[model samples]
Target: MELPPGWSALLEDYVAHLDAERGLSPHTVRAYRGDLVELARHCGVGPAEVTLPALRSWLSAMTDAGAASSTVQRRVACVRGFFGWARREGLVAEDPAARLTAPRRRRHLPRVPSRADVDLSLASVSARLSEGDNPLVHRDLALVEVLYSSGLRVSEACSLRLRDVDRERRALTVLGKGGKERTVPLGVPALRALDAWLHRRPEVAGPRSPETVFLGARGGAMDPRVARRVVHAATAGAGRGAETGPHGLRHAMATHLIDGGADLRSVQEMLGHSSVATTQIYTHVTSERLRQAFRQAHPRA
Candidate 1:
């Protein structure tokens, strides 16, 4: 269904607001635009004409169409935010999505690699680098080490700049979701890897390369997809049940921190999570691991 012209204009304005005023990341702005566009198309209504029933019906259709609960939940948040902004901007007389709700999302525990397994993987990567001085291998090793050490989201890692690294402090200034910036400390291993990569970076760096800390083969800013592939390949043979990727490495770092008795608030700060509740999931992962170990090694029921 084609969205009305008014609806299109309203969506564009809201997108601009999200980007320029709210300082949301491009990915987040795109997601908000997608959700609102789908809502407009589904309801055949402009922003001002949208009603609560229309909002609910849109969400109901998404559920009926087999969207994941988490996806629907995200859309619900998108709609509520858009409508709230619209109402404040006088684009609508009232907010229709204010009362909207979606199904609760299932809290699935993240897969976390053991420290030993992760060490084995990094050692393997180091072995590959020993075969010859490959810049790509250097970059990959540094990328994985940074992710595992700092618990940075893939986007934040890719967005990192040369200025973000403070070698003396052993910390990186990371820009995370919603443009929130925080300092995450690097482990000694990560700092070593990063030092190695920086030494080789000049060989691959193009003339116009940005100040991004990590770079692609062509010297452009590091692509998250490339970073993901690098991580997956590095960890592919780590021999854990769950396949590890950049995000899995992130989960692993957080889980390891919690396992080592780092406070939830500190992990939350390190991870740049907006809420301690988000950081608490690592505690769940650690607890489940203990349960599995107890079941395996206990002598009596």
Candidate 2:
């Protein structure tokens, strides 16, 4: 297949920049680079020739090739980033790729459990509190509380160590995606759950986990998938829809914060989103729901 001249080398440099400077994981860097490879083939020109028309044509070709909307959209974003980087580094004079837009993706909103539903889920865990018996209840409760309260990713929750919790500050330190670290606040319930679980965790941790916060029957770092499965099973029994997972709890945390008037920028930072636009999806969620409610109840059309 025909490929752009020197495009291969430039792509290597850009991918390296993404890895070393941006701290993107090798896997993520590779994913972004895959699209660039296709771009080189499509454009049939070097990085210097990335005019808007060529960019648009590449996207159109992706559409013709029957790429999924999400895939096409991500490739478009990668192209924009590449061109922006190129222009800023003087590889190009003006960013002709600036005006490019990704294919429109079907919009989806984060699912937030309602107030009554939230009470039911939390209360269900509390009510199922093993009454003086089962050892894993405390760990389970702590997991749910921390997930809903802090909106932590499953990996972050599983990665917790003994030293990461600051009891005095009511904060839990998390190593988020891309190896970024952030401090997440611990709510009262989460703290209490953590304390109780720490007590029982010593009993339940199998032989594996030595220092992680939530441990299995053999005392070791809890497996993330198991944590998710526990969340899935527990949420299913809580009467919420089956769609409720640990991520649903995370979404709930973001929505609860927004409804409580937390600024979008703060939530974006707390969630480790790179763009305010990514976080803005919650605004759309809240606004659309409000619109639906208003239209249904309002006296006027």
Candidate 3:
């Protein structure tokens, strides 16, 4: 859909603001741009020209078109953010989207892999590593171990450098969302696997390669996609049919930690979550487990 000529420039400015001032990732900025562009098309107006009625109608149309609740919520956020920026910049006399409300997002529990499944998967990966001195095998085992141990996001894991690991302390200096830095402790198994990979790292690391801890097949820094593939393959090899990724390992780590009686604040800090509320989701998982156990072991009748 073609937007007014001025709207294009406005969108470019908004995206730049998100990138520069907001420090949003490229992927996130692109999502905001896409959603705002759709709104501009639906309203057939420029940023300043959009009315509250038009904003409401656009949202209604999106919901009526069968958009998921999360999709609608994101779109609403995009509209609100764009107009909020515009209002502050004097592009609009008033924020039309100020009153816009989206459907409350459904809180679906994160899918966590069972401890047995994770154990089996790690056993399978370890068995492969025991077969030979393959550098890639060592790297894969370390990657999965670190992911499960630290609950590092795939991007965070891929972005790690040689200096990020503290060999003596068994800890990692992780840069997480919003460029926040946190130090997370590594388990003994993760430390051992990581040490093994470091020993064999030079065989594949090219002279031109950066000091990235995890290297790609060609010796460059490992891409997040490759890291995800390593996790997926390892999980599948354990005979688990469910789709699992690095983030699933993160979810599993948090749940397992909470189940082991770890405090919410400690888990929140470990996972680098800015808010403790985000870490509270693991309590729900624990509660659900108790519910299942009660149903199976106790019968009032």
User: Could you say which candidate leads in TM-score?
Assistant: 1
Q: For each candidate, what TM-score against the reference? A: 0.95, 0.75, 0.94
For candidate 2, the TM-score is 0.75
Clashing pairs in 3: none
Q: Kindly indicate the candidate among 2 and 3 with the higher TM-score.
A: 3
The reply for model 2, stretches above 4 Å from the true place, is 1-16, 33-58, 61-68, 80-100, 104-107, 131-134, 204-210, 216-219, 237-243
lDDT of 1: 0.89
- What root-mean-square deviation over C-alphas does model 3 reach? 1.9
Q: For residues 1-301, write the lDDT of model 2, one tens digit per residue.
A: 7566878777888998898888876667889998888888877777786678988888888789898998888887888888899888887788877888876897778666765666677787788785767878878889988998888988889888999999999998888778888887889988998898888776776555567888875666788888998787667744345248798787778887888899999898888787898889888878877899999999994
lDDT by residue (1-301, candidate 3, tens digit) is: 5896569998999998998887876778888898888888888877778999998898899889999999998888888989998999998899998998989888767767888888988998999976887899999999999999999999999999899999788899998876788999999999999999999999999889989899999999999999999999887743244338898899889999999989999999999988898788889988988988988888861
Candidate 2 clash pair list: 205-218, 205-219, 206-217, 206-218, 206-219, 207-218, 208-220, 209-219, 209-220, 209-221
